[model samples]
Target chain A: MLKYNFSAGPCVLPQEVFKKAADAVLDFNDLSILEISHRSKDFVQVMEQAQSLAFEHLGLQDKGYKALFLGGGASMQFLMCAYNLLENKAAYLNTGTWSAKAIKEAKMFGEVIEVASSKDSNYNHIPKSYSVPSDVDYFHFQTNNTIFGTQLQETPSVEVPIVCDMSSDIFSRQRDFDKYDLIYAGAQKNMGPAGATLVVVKEEILGKVSRSIPSMLDYKVHISKDSMFNTPPVFPIYVSMLTMQWLKDNGGISWIEELNNKKAGLIYNEIDRNPLFEGFVTDKADRSKMNATFVLKDEAHKDAFDQLWKDAGINGLNGHRSVGGYRASMYNALSVEAVETLVSVMQELERKG
Target chain B: MLKYNFSAGPCVLPQEVFKKAADAVLDFNDLSILEISHRSKDFVQVMEQAQSLAFEHLGLQDKGYKALFLGGGASMQFLMCAYNLLENKAAYLNTGTWSAKAIKEAKMFGEVIEVASSKDSNYNHIPKSYSVPSDVDYFHFQTNNTIFGTQLQETPSVEVPIVCDMSSDIFSRQRDFDKYDLIYAGAQKNMGPAGATLVVVKEEILGKVSRSIPSMLDYKVHISKDSMFNTPPVFPIYVSMLTMQWLKDNGGISWIEELNNKKAGLIYNEIDRNPLFEGFVTDKADRSKMNATFVLKDEAHKDAFDQLWKDAGINGLNGHRSVGGYRASMYNALSVEAVETLVSVMQELERKG
Candidate 1:
């Protein structure tokens, strides 16, 4: 049962991180991680280290941006982002399901303008061009689509503030850390587990919206309280601290970005070169470096490709149910050697075809 | 340091559960618990077993009640309960800080009538007499108050519906589970860690609220999707399952209730007998069996008592900052011997006095 984990979110983490997490579970500094009080000096240090590490990894330190580790996942942020920032209006790019969901949540707070979209082509590409309005409070978009295998390559440079949900692609790439006004990601994809959500927000942008917000939902409250407004998901935050430290030791975001692209490039090259397979993304530039979605050239090869991967000790190669194909998620933990194994499988599939 | 954990929550769990959780983190059936996909067969089974165990422990199986494990803590449920159930009007009994906070959230949805309040006396006791109007849609009350160390001994017999927040005292004792339309707990105090929130709701009570509820906050959406409305707090839920299973093995709520009462009685007896200490609760019956709060007869003995508990290798016995005293939370996991050590410490303090 030793297999490469290809899950999109709640995916694989560094093996050393896993070991440390296990040890902490047994005894977090001699106190069981399960039993550590949230207010204890030991756990408070853990929380503070987790936040600083996240801010360091994101390169947001000393920039008036506070990184918060909250309990709910990215899904909760759909409504929370709007609750904190969507004052009179906002603009959102319709990239995929996450963007659309964000738009839906934002609509309740104010008028939201969909500047551009690629849904007409089943989201095979991230829209290249979009016009943001100056009247809108902020422009929001999803950085990577787990289901569609598309990603925004360029950060949208707009006059207004930019909000991004980097849930599926965070820590996989190094971008202008100071570019956006707000950024949130569910920790499951690249950071650690499914419980904690990482939120980095500029202090100045909050308290601008003309609406009463719940203390938990308000980013200002989280920032002011340093993300301990209430009891948080302690185990998830601890594991994530380990993972962030791993990223730091392993040359930070730029090095991981290079490694990620190397793996993704190998798989995409196989999809393009192989006769029996083709990339699902129409725009090669817009294709995700994290989630590589592709399909068999013909329907007849479905069973063979399926059995081939299963026999090769690959799991989670099946694509999302909404878009049926094969998706190989290449997060930071996925080794290039694993991608080479996948490339070898592609070569085998081609020969059989 | 090897010590007895007396933190309210994230409090101690069974030592066996801690060992099991650590093992699972290392290798959950050949897959690291962190790497297992939420949709994977093994994890799905884990989720299923967790929900069923919670319902069974509550004695609500096949009673049209669906148990849900979601990401947010009990604080989120304060708003979610009102968002789902508050229609025209609701009745609230404000016993302590938690009850008052629940009332604050419920007021945002509809009219809330405070049927009774013990806040006039700093919530030293649960109000014994209150007439719940038959016209209100649902009645909300907290089963146990952690900081104030008060508890509702009798379930409120309301005509419309009953909702309870069992965060601090769930699984410590058993009562008539059929009386309430909804019950929710943050799985940290008597349950497990501080990530997963357990909600058991009557299927028929939802969809009655007129306003739109966020998908993540809607109980019906979570119930229909089986709490997979999003990626759940996997590690916390897993540990909670292990704890609940341990409870079952050790003779469910009734046996734990007996053990809890013994520990509370020992501590209360010490408080009564020893001239150095006095109980905080005005009514003996209203005092929480789980969280036993008391104070030194004189603040002059503070250093001695503090040193005494520390010398006994106890942790988290300090009362909440809001209430400056000491609280020894005797949750299901705290052993009778631990309480015995505390009682001995109190006895030693009296001898010194």
Candidate 2:
């Protein structure tokens, strides 16, 4: 059976990306990618290409934003962001689990004022009309909630410098990339694998905190070293470069947004049309284009519905335990045909019911 | 040409490990290793197996050690070790660059007492006859210095808990594994690649510090989560596991220790015998079995010596700029045959000169 991976992350990347990555493992300029020095001319070129491509894809070229592919995942960024920027106070919008975690770390550095939170409804919708304090050091928010399947479609027009965690939905749609002072995303989503995290930060926003930051956690230290402060996650960054190249070769973020819209449209429309299933998010407008969470209306049909998707060659369709149902993650590499197969599975379950 | 990689990591792994890693990249249980979820049963097994192998190799099984494969490299551990263990003060033995770095981070948390330092002689030998202060929170030292090619031969008989950074030489030889409370090594050397860091820590020594540690930096939190607090560097860990398996299949640490000693002996003997070359370390007994540092007796023969090695397919033989000469890093996976090949190039240079 043909397989379609809907894993939330360390998720599906493009097939061509995998082929090139595997090839590099055997022979990248006559050296195994695993064995090459990060400072060697070849691997340095890879690091440079990855950073440049990140700038190109985000449309932040020559805009005083430095692109760094660092390790420790986006979770590290939650602490580092606060460690670097949280001087006296900061404002945050808590959408779900990740945001709450980010807020928890930020509070360790300084006072955190939550502008708004949607946790009351188990994060079923993105909170709107929140006000950021003018006196706070910066404003932070997560662009998409992977657990709750909600997304903030537009950037909040906050006057203070904005720090955004775009882990689940970065580069999947068009946006004014320059609005945020710092943007971080783990590579597992649409970029590459799980080892590296992409951090695009504006230079001016750093060096504001008075406390001494550890070398590994300080963004300015990494920026000065050009992301080679320590040995980087080389294989992950190289595969990420291939991925960014794939995105650009197939016409950048604008091109993928349309395909993603089509994919999200297919399954979400079926959920609305079929009587057996119900969407988990309370608001349709807040549904994430990357991950679609839903469940069967009748518990009696659960086993047959599970069998239908399993037999149809789908992987990672199970929702997070916090959201207890099914989640079909439609990332940049997930094709519309995969979504159609899922829809057919849902329809077959309804027919059986 | 058969190339021998001697880069001080992201360095050489076994060719068989590379082949298997490459194959898994294309397909690991019906999905790309890059695409699978870290929480999946298969990857969880990989994590469990890696942890168990680490314990088994260190001879610390059924002891108090918890093996964790973490991201951010050993640099992250520098701060984390201090944050979690340093309440009032710690004693650090300054052997070389890495030890100096670890000392710098420890100072951020509290007073750092330098028990001994070999910096006056440019770290040419490991300091001897120094007493670790019993009043200190812990005694810290690096087992191997890759840059200066020096190593501490035995665990110090310190009363306080010991913390170790074995980035370059972990699992390359046998030692009293239970003597230290914490041990960390970057995965690039001997293990696999550059993304993950292997941390083995005792559970009893934690929760003693008053400082509030960040979630990512706390080893206890990572241990509680089984190193899955968030997405891990999956590819690096998997490759590390395969390399550990390779080491075990060939008879574990004692077996590799004999091979490593032979490899070190061959090159060190050649460096001493050849009139054109000289070993860098001041004390022969302090020389590292992992990396052997040496220089040409006369600068005039540098070009000829360089060409001989390049012609013989030796890579990364150039020494670090801080100690300008040459370094032959013989990690666990590096064969004695490769060492013999390097020694032959040294002999060829002497003949040409």
Query: Tens-digit lDDT track for model 1 on B153-197?
Result: 888777989999999999988889899899999999888888999
| TM match of model 1 to true structure | 0.98
DockQ for every model comes to: 0.75, 0.79
Off by over 4 Å in 2: none
The 10 consecutive residues of candidate 1 chain B with the worst lDDT sum are B1-10
Instruction: Give the chain A TM-score for each candidate.
Output: 0.98, 0.99
**What ranges in model 1 sit over 4 Å off?**
none
Clashes of 1: 0
Predicted structure with the largest DockQ when compared to the true one: 2
> Where is the poorest 10-residue window by lDDT in model 2 chain A?
A1-10
Residue pairs in collision within model 1: none
**Candidate with the greatest TM-score versus the true structure:** 2
lDDT of 1 by residue, A1-353 (tens): 56787888788888999889888877777788888888888889988998888888788899988888988799899999898888898999998988888888888888999999888988888887668988899999998999999988888788999889999999899888699989999999899988999989988888987777776687887777778888989999999989989999989998999999899889999999998888889999999999999988798999988888878888789998877889999999999988998899989988888
